[model samples]
Target: MKRKIGWVLAAALLVLLAAGGCAPKTPTAKKKPTPVKTEQKAETVPTYRVVADNNLDKFKQTHGQYRTINYDPQDDLVSLLPESLAKLKKYPQTTTVRAYVTDWQQASVQMGSKPMTVLTVQVQKVLTGKKQLAKQEIRLILPGGFQPYGQYDKGSIYHDNTIPDDEPVLTQNNQIPIPTIGSTIVLPMRKAAQYPAKEYLAWLKAAKLTTAYVPADAHSMIWRCNPQTKKLTTNNPLREKELTKWAGQGNQTWATQYKRLTAELEKQL
Candidate 1:
């Protein structure tokens, strides 16, 4: 009986050993931790502010009392002849027209000691002109950057600044509090003209108008027609190239119209 019991115990020990040998082995090397990735936030940029003119008091004293002149398309002269036309014969007089300020920009050239504003205006009615120029848009460069003063939207009444004279002032669209037309103020404008009607239609067939801006200057070669004379005037080559590049980035419609007007003029050349 004792021998049988000993054999039984020995069998149990063998079973336990076999179970231990079949078990999986533990790992010897330690596992590495995963690296953490960090994300960064982007920085924001601020808009530029126009430096306020400190000469306001002096300007008021010199120019006299501040009087707001409301815009009146019917009686006010809104467009002026280009400085180039100042000496030209048969040059047309500055005209009064009803127009809207579609957009505005800072004049690339500075005035006296301050920056000027260039307003993009669309003509709605021609109050006074030899030829009625309606449904046209042109650029007008004013004396100062008036954009900071008020909102310039489609409905804003853009009138002459009478107190200082010649400068432009803006009243909110649909809000014309004053109802007076003071001494007329004319905007420095680039007038658009076409080849004579008889010549323009025929010229469009064979030639195309290409419009571009004159560099460092607001004038567009596309808007101005070639003088009636066949002689081509010499231009500053370097300046021309620069303006062309600048116009390439501006309003394409304005450029296209300029090109069309220019192409018509070029036919005469």
Candidate 2:
């Protein structure tokens, strides 16, 4: 009976091993690695030009280190339009011309707290004022061009009382771009003394300029003419309003003058 029981147990074990061999195997799952996170930095864009003494030195040797100035002028439409009209009346020599900015020189004289940037423009046509200035090059000393910056002391006449806190404190104040070389512009100007006669003459001799002029009214009087459309425009918003106001006034003389000037500007190259 013990031999028969052992044989039956062995046969049962063999049958169980056969069943295990015929069955399919289970697949094991692999553990995936956690993904890594990366951080990206943002790029910065420059809104305005930051000029320094080194930049002015490229044109001429500068004497002092560049200093930040409160250079924002009271250039609102209300202030500018009346002031401009007064200047136009005072200086009847104010002429409108289409010109090309050939080159520029940094003058020694200071406009408030900065050295003036003088532009040498070749007159292509005279829209108003002297007709003889056509085909001649002239110099214009404007207030707000690229220049080494400085500030007046408190209570000083030149001190800018209303400079905003958000305004950039830089070595130069170029509210609008200095007219680039080879770009065409339509400008209204008048003969003016940037400095005393002796000083002005010395600068003119040194810079090789015969005479220097100034904008008739304000920066808004300077216009960049579209080459294709021949439409005149200004980058200075306050001056643009001043121009528009001056054009829209009830005075027929100014309206007539503005019309003639625009017509002449359209005819130029």
Candidate 3:
């Protein structure tokens, strides 16, 4: 009877051991950690506090687009002259128009309830294929009025909102007819205004800006001047330097011519 009891106890012990072995495992230690995202933060966007370009942001644009919705378009003299001067050879009076960026024209260029820069623009020529653009180009378009006798003296751009009081001025545009009415005037001067109208047109045609590669790189910069349309588009270091030097020289020349025209126009007025 003692031996039989011992055998039964051994069998029970074996069954208990088997059940314990079949139990689920307590998980092994893991070293893989969850990654923390850093790139999705808000500070990555590009923004430049370019208020220092000429301290242009000093004033406020009171007559906003929404606020002045009821105002007559005729009330603006500066905006009126460019179109009006289409048929006329000279300005009715000795007028000056200042240039500014398109967006901040009212607030930044405005003077104590007045505008500091009354600018103008005209499309000389538009070229549509690929053209090269230099590092420094004049981006601002002025509607100051362009005449055979007029010029934009970039060298004499003295004050914060001042254009060289005299220069061969032209507006910037990429479309329209060749040698469009007021563009190539009979100045009897070799140094006349020119815009890459054909190149600009080509750019418009192919949906390109200056070249076949696209103007993606230069899209953000201020256009120092429209591309010279005559050349086959290619990046040229000399071209860049020449553009800057030529602009200075051209502006100086225009200053001399401006003095002459201002006097001539003043006498006529």
Give the alpha-carbon lDDT of every model.
Answer: 0.36, 0.59, 0.27
Per-model root-mean-square deviation over C-alphas: 20.4, 14.4, 21.4
Question: In model 3, which regions exceed 4 Å deviation?
Answer: 1-5, 18-56, 59-130, 134-136, 139-269
How many clashes would you count in candidate 2?
0
Candidate 1's residue-wise lDDT over 1-269, tens digit each?
99999999999999999999999999789878888887686664211101112233333454454333333224332222223322221334444343444444555544333344444455544434423556655554433343322332233465223233333343221111211111111221223223246443343322221110111122222122122442222122333454477588874554344345333333433
lDDT of 2 by residue, 134-228 (tens): 98878877543333222333455764546643343333333444665556788777776544588666655664544678776545456788767
- Residues 169-254, candidate 3: write the lDDT tens digits: 33221111012111111110000123345643442334212211111111111122212331121122333454457567775452
Q: List candidate 1 segments past 4 Å from native.
A: 1-92, 130-132, 146-269
Over 4 Å off in model 2, which ranges?
1-71, 75-91, 145-177, 194-210, 240-269
Q: Determine which window of 10 residues in candidate 1 has minimal summed lDDT.
A: 175-184
TM-score of each: 0.24, 0.48, 0.23
- What is the clash count of model 3? 44
Q: Which ten residues in a row have the lowest lDDT in candidate 2?
A: 45-54
Residue-level lDDT for 204 in candidate 3? 31
